[model samples]
Target: MTFTPVTPSDIAPGTTRFVQHEGAAFLVVRDGDGRVHALDGLCSHALLPLAGARVRRGHVICPHHGARFDITTGAAKGPPAHCGVSHYPAQEKDGMIELDLNP
Candidate 1:
């Protein structure tokens, strides 16, 4: 996948934002340390939208069944979600947040 540009200001520190690229939904988050991460917007357990999912302790808690996934590695960190979601490489460039959708 190619790098898609997004508004950096839309995602604040310690918050999450939903973005669409090439007709696919993606979740972009800014950690407490101000680092950006990108992940597939759907939960692996039931394919539920993870847009409003809570971010705590470096994990995104699924709103549907309480599944938690690591923001950095996309690893499943709790029950009800044995499988992990997909993670994309993200970085800041030219005052924008760029995500590698193909990663």
Candidate 2:
């Protein structure tokens, strides 16, 4: 697995940030527990962008249409998004956010 390093300060705790690696878009989220997650940056229901999404209770709520997805498994947990987004492996190490988009 190839892990790309992202500046940890780019994203704050309890918030989501949109990022791109190689040619793929991803959402880097830090939940209330300070755990980091990497998920596909698009909402499955409408293919809408998930940038600036709200992270609550280990889930990322879609800014549009109120779809919710699990941060760890990418499972769609709410309406308007039956299909889940892709969840990539992510970790915080060496004071950086590392993610594997191809994993």
Candidate 3:
């Protein structure tokens, strides 16, 4: 679990932010309730960026093909994305959001 610290101020509540670390792209999302999640930046369906997608009820809808993925478990919740995305462990501590980059 190699965690990388990210600035908490960079992520606004109820929005998804794109970040890159060690040549890997990750999507860091802060839900409406303040819970933060990190997942593979690309959608499983079309390999499109998930940062521009919409987050609704803990699921992220792929902007390209309407594929929905659960932010917490990275489960494919709808059509087009039968394969689930990768979910990384995330935590907030000391005003910083730390993500497990190796996960």
Better of 1 and 3 by lDDT: 1
Query: What value does the lDDT take at residue 7 in candidate 2?
Result: 50
Model 3: CA > 4 A from native: none
Candidate 2, residues 38-57, lDDT tens digits: the string is: 99988999998898789888
Give each model's whole-structure lDDT: 0.87, 0.87, 0.84
The residue-level lDDT of candidate 2 at 66 comes to 94
Instruction: Give a tens-digit lDDT track for model 3, residues 1-103.
Output: 6778865646777788877777777788888888899888888888878868778988888878899989899999999999998998999878788888676
Evaluated at residue 28, the lDDT of candidate 2 is 91
Which rank order by lDDT, best down to worst? 2, 1, 3
Residue 97 local lDDT, model 1 = 91
Q: For each predicted model, how many residue pairs clash, with residues at least 3 apart or on different chains?
A: 1, 0, 0
Report the error of model 3 at residue 91, Å: 1.1
Give RMSD (Å) of candidate 1 vs. truth. 1.6
